[model samples]
Target: MKRVFVTVGTTSFDELIERVTTPEATQALKARGYQHLVLQVGRGSILPDSDSCHELTLEVFRFKDSIAEDIKCADLVISHAGAGSCLETLGAGKPLLVVVNDQLMNNHQLELADQLYQDAHLLYCTPSTLIETLKMMDLSVLSPFLPGKPKNFADFLDKALGVQ
Candidate 1:
């Protein structure tokens, strides 16, 4: 059985937590042999109040410094489109599904999420289609991540110094 870690960063994301803990979503996840569904709520307004939560090993927390430990243990990571979370998940080489929080001011997360999806670097889904997207995800198709910093620093320095 696999584990799933759903992290919403340090901001409230009640909508996301609610969606992931939904009966249908839980059922689908159980079908996929997920043994645990853990939520890093991060001040999120929603709590696991549904009876269906008992159907699985569901855990919720406000925040934790050891997110990488959870991410490392998880077979899959479902997260907000925040860059830190995206980079961490990708850097860990886990199959990630990012849902944009359009309500955030300026909504840059959507841009990052869409760009990563288009690049085949990660998976993206809206609040409405999260479960469906998860069911259809094929981790094999995800592009391997090589951080831009290490891979592009030389090119960046060359451009900055006007060297060939």
Candidate 2:
């Protein structure tokens, strides 16, 4: 079955969790041919009432040892804008939609998500814009995330430090 996996990583982003499970969002996902939605809700307080979401099967969990398997199994990934979660999903070569938590102080996530979006690696939006983004998103536009060579970082550091 085609699956869409939503993850909020280790923190709470209750808004994202709630938005994606709304009837409009579920209908949009269904229209796109997704059959199952599995959410890693983290510490979010709102667990969706699955019965209200028609024509889609929903699974919700708070935490897991690793979500690598889930990412691999997904046809698409909706994630919080945490660096780890974004890298993991992008590295898996899945179509990614990152939701930025505007409530946070400092809010570095927005910066990372913006750069990735500009790079065409993924799509991003605020929780309030999720449905519109979902309706408009086309996974075909994304470029596969090609990881840099292991030596690239070391080379950059060497150049910066002026080490021969």
Candidate 3:
């Protein structure tokens, strides 16, 4: 069964969870040939009612030590616009759609998501736009996010610190 994994990482984004589990969203996914929906709901107070959707199988959980396995198995990943979640999903070569949480104060998530979107690494939207994005997104256009060298950060740090 093709799966779409939705992750909020360790932070809460109940809006995203609630939006994706809606009947409309579920039907959109089903129409796209996704049979399974797995969600890591994070600290969201909302518990998904999987029984409402008969067309697709739903799996919901709060948190995990690692979501690598879920990413590996997903045909698509819908995630919050956190750097870790975004990078991990893209690194796994999964099509990623990042949902920017607009409620946060001075949100950097939007900036990151927008940059990645511009680079064709992933698609991004707000919770309000998620349904439309899901229905219309063409996953074929996303480019694989090739990871940069780990030493790049170290070199940058060294340069900033004026170390030779």
> Model 1: per-residue lDDT, tens digit, 46-146?
87743458547987788887799999999989999898899899989898988877577577667777788899988887778887876777778889887
TM-scores for every predicted model: 0.85, 0.89, 0.88
lDDT per residue as tens, model 3, 74-132:
99999988888888888888999998888874777667778999999999889999999
- Give each model's whole-structure lDDT: 0.83, 0.90, 0.90
How many residue pairs clash per model? 0, 0, 0
* Model 1: ten consecutive residues of lowest lDDT: 47-56
**CA-only RMSD, every prediction:** 3.1, 2.6, 3.0
List candidate 1 segments past 4 Å from native. 49-52, 149-164
How many backbone clashes are present in model 1?
0
Best model number under TM-score: 2
Compared with the true structure, the alpha-carbon lDDT of candidate 1 equals 0.83
Candidate 3 local lDDT, residue 102: 83
